[model samples]
Target: MRRTSARSRISRALAVATAVAAVAGLTAYQGVAAEPAARTLAAGSPEGYGAGTTGGAGGPTVTVTSADAFIDAAASDGPLQIQVNGTIQLDDMEKVTSNKTIVGTGTRGRITGGGLNVSKASNVIIQNLTFSGSDDDAINVQYSTRVWIDHNDISDAYDGACDVKRASDGVTVSWNHFHDQDKNALLGHSDDNGSEDRGKLHVSYHHNWFDATTQRNPRVRFGNPVHVYNNYYYNNSGYGVASTEEAGVLVEGNYFENVKDPYHLGEADSGPGSLVARNNQLVNSGSGQTGGSVSTPSYSYRLDPAANVKSIVTSGSGVGHV
Candidate 1:
């Protein structure tokens, strides 16, 4: 394991102090009471199935400003915190190994012309970054466990913005802004891979801003007890969530504005799955199709009010907000 440098520790401490003071000042100036401590897990923090996910928490922190440095730090062994400081350009998807925290510096961190691949890795966190113009999916997690993807701006990817497939379990996707793209998020890869996918792919999708995205506000397959809650869907041209290939999905407490299809039980070529839709607010949206029985989540979480989901998601999602 790498050791934290004195300069990095001091910088991190000052940053934390600055953020605390800013938050306090804002609350005092607005005359609004602070949110409950439990609400801290609502956006940036990992919860639900990924509650145990800790990425490079006790590892050394290294700042990377170029593609070469970023790639080197990501592929290094053991626990590590890789801070992206500026736009790092690449030609294709790059690998991120196990036990890594790849976070952006303020709002200036970005990855363009490429994306990240977390293949066969575990305990990874990717947060507070802007990703655009990727040659492939903005973030691809396959055969990975305990991964958290939060508070990022993802758009214009060649494929899905975030795709978790091939038995990726204990995953959480939260507080991300997905816009101007098709195939926004996917939870499974193929319909015939149930041998490897069955009884796995447990994921939590919450507080994500699906803004004008076309389809696959996570099209899921063979993932039982997949929880989708408190998400905001606005002006989506295609649809919201799709549960197919015998998957079980619980969709609840979401706000859908001007979306034709908020969620459904099946999709093209794939057999119908099980879905339970509850407490979702649909404004000018079609009533979604549903069938079969879905399982309840084992973890505990606080749900934001459906009526306030739009405001909460838009204000807190994307880079620099966390």
Candidate 2:
């Protein structure tokens, strides 16, 4: 979020001055202070930070109001944190570069009528933002790795709200709210693009609130083992999670209320995949099919109870309050 106004700048300056003065006083009195604690990703979240991800670590924040500037800030060399204050409308696709953390300031921060392209980027984290009316995908990631998308509200996109494809690996999508959308999310691009997609696209999708989304609460493709867990689904018109085109998915501990299709192994014409469904709660909904089993993920995550998913997700999912 940008401090563009004079009042905002003055307020920030005064706040910084007060903080510096207080810190100096405390240091002088105590003679020394404790070392800062090391930062970690949110607990039980399995986003890879082993060798390829450091999203905006120890970098200055660059606040902007336009989509072009946001992309420019992300495209810079070093890790950077980019904040968008108000809604930014775009006429073209904005490409987010590598090693960036893009966060919205508050409830009013949003991206409208545009799309974010996270192609070939690594260590990117996008959170606390609202995306709507996008001419294309609200957020598209291809050939990327170690990305985390959390606490966002995405709706009414022209294409899929969030699509990850082209061998993207080690990603986590958590605590997002999806409503009034169609083709919500997609894992792989196509069935024919199998070679590039093989043995890639490992992701964790958890704690999301999907309300009335039409379909593709992530339709998956080949060589992807997506873990879908502890999500809340309300009155969904289409399927909840589809594991198609040889894709493997583990659907577990989800709450489905009045949804038509809670989970399925494959699409209408797509090749059959594998899914393991367990501990799901269904109320006035269909418990979808399970064909085979998928291999377990290489990471660990704590799963919330399916019976309490509605309460847990409703109280914490989406932007502005994170």
Candidate that would win on lDDT: 1
**Regions of candidate 1 where Cα sits further than 4 Å from its true position:** 1-44
- In model 2, state the lDDT of residue 93: 66
- Per-residue CA lDDT of model 1 for 1-322, tens digit only, reads 1123433333443344335533432121111111111112212459888887878765555566667667666776776677777898978889999988888879888999999999999999999999999989999999999999999999999988999999999999999999989998999889999999999999999999999999999899999999999999999888999999979999999999999999987899998899999999999999988888999999999999999999999999999798
Residue pairs with backbone atoms closer than 3 Å in model 2 (clashes) = none
Residue-pair clashes per prediction, in order, are 0, 0
Error (Å) of candidate 1 at residue 69 is 0.3
Q: Per-candidate TM vs. native?
A: 0.87, 0.84
List the global CA lDDT of all models: 0.84, 0.76
lDDT of 2 at 190: 89
lDDT of model number 1: 0.84
Q: What are the runs in model 2 whose C-alpha is more than 4 Å off?
A: 1-53
